[model samples]
Target chain A: MTTLPTPGAVRLGLVIDLDICVGCHACAVNCKEWNTGGNAGPLSDYQPYEAQPDGVWFNRVHSYEVGDGPAGQTVHFPRSCLHCDNAECVTVCPTGASLKRAEDGIVLINEDVCIGCKLCSWACPYGAREFDEDVGVMRKCTLCVDRIYDEARPEAERVPACVSTCPASARHFGDLGDPASDVSRMVADREGMALMPELGYRPTNRYLPPRAKGSGCSAHAKSPALEPVMPEGTGFLGWLDRLLSA
Target chain B: MHPALSVILFTVASGIGYGMLMLLALFLPLAAGPADRLFGAVSLGLALACIGGGLLSSTAHLGRPERAWRAFTQWRSSWLSREGVLAVLSLVAIALLTLAWPILAAPVECIEMTAAIAGLLSAATVAATAMIYRSLKPIARWHNRWTVPCYLTIALASGGLWLDWAGAATGVDFLPRAVAPILVLLAAVVKALYWRHTDGLKSATTIGTATGLGALGQVRPLDPPHTAANYIMKEMGFRIARKHAAKLRRIAGGLGVLAPLLLVIAGGMVPALDRSAVLLAAPVATIGVLVERWLFFAEAQHVAMLYYKADAV
Candidate 1:
């Protein structure tokens, strides 16, 4: 169905721990390797081993300088399709090529019907969608759709290529819709958050915020445990407390 | 946001085409012109060609033009689909009016009905085209209140300039000539307001907010994800230099608004040059709208840019 699934549906997604990620881009590389040969195979590269090598990548890792002065930190951010509940990419499609699976909440494009309008790319705030120049169609993260459901593969290996390949074990894949799920528990514990919440895409994917660095926060600098003095209802600890109690 | 030539031409041409068709629809039914077979054929034929050619030009940019028919099936959700459906329907309605023009000796009741339908459909299609851009919340410049009004007025202004000439050629010049200048002025005012409104605004999404790291003092892109420019950057990171945009905006205003307004007024005041002045104004106004249309895409800052080096999208 093109419309969003009701809340509390099986919203399968990722939880990336920013603190642990080393910015190695192993996930990105492995993603390209596995997906290029998978269902959405032969991900096009325009000029490989040439002046400017360009291709379609479902995942990208960016490094950012967070905070300021000595308190500032370098944070590695791996971006991909968040599989937003209100997936703008799906609705903007003139052809019914882009669809969000009502059962699992995975946003997908039926390439056969795809006219390659590229409007889906624009609708995505995360820059997740990539247009294949060679194929002349849009390609994006399928959340390792082919491998995820394959009963033949070993249970451990059934996870997404990115999650399975993360060197630091920073990336995770599970049902985020269930608070009891491992990924959802990780979100509650680490105070993971979505990117650009103001836009209201309601992305299922969560990013575990990087810990405080330098002299940014005295409480964080001292220890991960114990509370800093903030309002009773504020900060991650308070949020976690509320989640745990509820 | 890359300003593809095909899209620029499509918007400019179709905009004017629809504009002219709308005016012709009303004028034909009301007997604004002689309603002779030759004048009907030439005027309606010219309008249809512009609209048809412009619509065809749009398909050239599609990655898979062969599957464009599938675009019509999703009008329930997509504005582009709605536009596709409307464009074809308006074409059929206009084509009917065009066919009726040369064949029918007298004004038929069916002609009046068809013209009304054509006019509404043409107006709706043009509005839908504007909505295609205006509905995109990621593009702050396009999603604003000013976009639709700017599109509608500009279309009328540019299309009416030629309609004035056609009216004069068919022995009824006064009405179109008078109205074209007013439309030009209204379009100019709207265009100016749109520019002014967007100038002070910044894309709501910032790099910090995009990364969900704003609360962490300051944030900046340290290492880009890839060495090569990705699809997002290539497509959405298009930035025009300030001077160039300013210069083009002036050119658009001069040719599209001021020139057309003056020429149409001149066509009215100077009876000798009359229709010729209006004729000269049409292409000038179209080129102006063409440039403006290009700027529409070029100036739009996509929200995705916040992840890349953009401080604000």
Candidate 2:
């Protein structure tokens, strides 16, 4: 049951644009909020108001400073389950609790059957699965399976909680299995890359690279021409007048 | 890579149990008179106790120990499941052989065949256990060609020590005292080679590759995602100081391999001290192997740590 389905079979995934992400963490926050009460609900938090607080979250945003000095740019990376084509997390589950959907390629864990041995988390190279200490089960990004397929919700707003709530509009969700799909085209056009492609998990999600520094119209863009300021009068009188006027 | 006590205990205890079971099977046909019965009973008892204790300890770490029976259903895909099935099979075979030994009287061809089958199954179970760790591609330290042989050798060496002790205590020379020493030395060399290989290993994936940002110059973590350590960090971010690891390796090698070797040789030289020497060697070798197992988990770096700015894993 843990064996993966054939590749390119309705691979619904996300394309995150790193160029537009503002490190706001809205996606991660919304993800926690929606999933805490959703299918994998009550993502437990321990010591909420104490000195050390720990909890299970399906999504997390990590910020990094890429490059150096003036050329450096802050890159906020949100990581979650990639819903890999060859998901080792699913294959390594001794109880067949971890499963990948052949229909939409959404990987999920059956909480009732999960022994919570934590092997899936270890097998996952992306650090996606979270262990719910309180429930004694493994939790992870379901790609909002409860929300995406819910007919009661408006069709336009039925994307993943993270993608729907991203204020910067940095996250896009669509069928990655189709080359012509919006998300897949976005990936192709933006040259989005798979995280840790060398490991060969064949992650469904893609990350669009940030634009080159000084290439776009921004406040930091240098002006080609400059005009020197001239005082109304020459010498000490002009300098004193300019200083007083400033 | 938390190196939980339950897992360390499980691997070590079960390895020793299975090793002893295999050796016992090989020696069962050579036994004569009541001594054969005594040796069979005692060896099988020790084997069963260790195996059963280890299996129980393994379940302790699971959230739902009661549901452990479900683990056996996935042997086709999971090594852990295969290990469970194999352990049960080996246990059944060994139990039958032990219980039927008295009724069977002297050595019979069928009994020998059964013992041989049980021994092979026990060895297979240990191999399955080793594969559980070795197949994990995410942990660079575990996924290697050396892991399987290292596990088998250690199991054989530890079991050999116990066998020697059991034989000496009963005044039954079932196997040569030299066998244990030879096995210990072989295990030592393999373990040393494994250590050297891991020490020189450069992680296949780097932080740059992990994030798919190698094109961006020198990506460094500006801030972690959470204020406090989360599951990923807690489970995979475990780090041990270099000096401490080196010291533990020395202790493991010296106590686990060298000490046992010396004791076994000493026991051979002095007939009177044979029993005490072999007895002392068992515990010493066990402690040494325990240290080795601890380091195995402590030093393993999971690939997931790359997200938290681990340069390589």
Judged by lDDT, which candidate is best? 2
* Model 2 whole-model lDDT (C-alpha atoms): 0.86
Q: List candidate 2 stretches off by more than 4 Å.
A: A215-246, B30-35, B102-107, B241-243
TM-scores of chain B, in order: 0.94, 0.95
Cα lDDT tens digits for candidate 1, B142-180: 888999998888888777876766666776543434678
User: How do the predictions measure up, each by TM-score?
Assistant: 0.92, 0.94
| CAPRI rating of model 2 | medium
List runs of model 1 lying over 4 Å from the truth.
A1-8, A214-246, B32-34, B168-174, B241-243
**Considering only chain A, what is the TM-score of each predicted structure?**
0.85, 0.89
lDDT of 1: 0.84
